[model samples]
Target: NAGVTQTPKFRILKIGQSMTLQCTQDMNHNYMYWYRQDPGMGLKLIYYSVGAGITDKGEVPNGYNVSRSTTEDFPLRLELAAPSQTSVYFCASGRNQPQHFGDGTRLSIL
Candidate 1:
């Protein structure tokens, strides 16, 4: 627990099945992000990476998918699993602004 850390905080899918929501950040700062909090609206970005192999795609990347290679992992791939993708997933970082989340991952799909 140095900054960002998320694991099976909670999950439940059955529409298609496929999970991989794990993010790590030792406060190295490298512009990393991944958001999805649909319940009232606000966070939406789905994938983002500014280091380690590099990656991009925000504002909801379809079923979702992401990776960052190093600088403290950054995984988030949800193939299938519908039901509007449930919601409640946050993993972020920063290096020149604001961003620091993790403590969310409540997914549910029936």
Candidate 2:
């Protein structure tokens, strides 16, 4: 019934700044995910939630935080942004494996 949506398609931040990458889905999925893809590299899972009020760390959870307050929202937070954190972030949702992905957020840290 819905697809993934991400905000701030692009952003530039100075080292140590903090920001939240917004993600939302309207498909009423039980599984939601966040992933970061560095240049020339495959996507690394940052975090995932099986349902509302539950979350778990993934392969590259450092420097990132996620919360699933409702089935439709899963936001990724970055505190003290670092240059190494620069990458394209993708939000996905599905019943099993991800079925929908947002356009992606291109983040750059100076």
Residue 59 shift from truth in candidate 1, angstroms: 32
| Backbone N/Cα/C clashes per model | 0, 0
Please list the Cα RMSD from the true structure of every candidate, rounded to 1 decimal place. 11.6, 0.9
Model 2 misplacement above 4 A: none
Q: Please give the CA lDDT of all the candidate structures.
A: 0.86, 0.95
Q: What TM-score does each of the candidates earn? A: 0.32, 0.97
lDDT of 2: 0.95
Candidate 2 lDDT over 1-110, as tens digits, reads 44899998999999999999999999999999999999999999999999999999999999999999999999999999999999999999999899899999999999
Which pairs in model 2 have colliding backbones? none
Cα lDDT for residue 44, model 1? 83
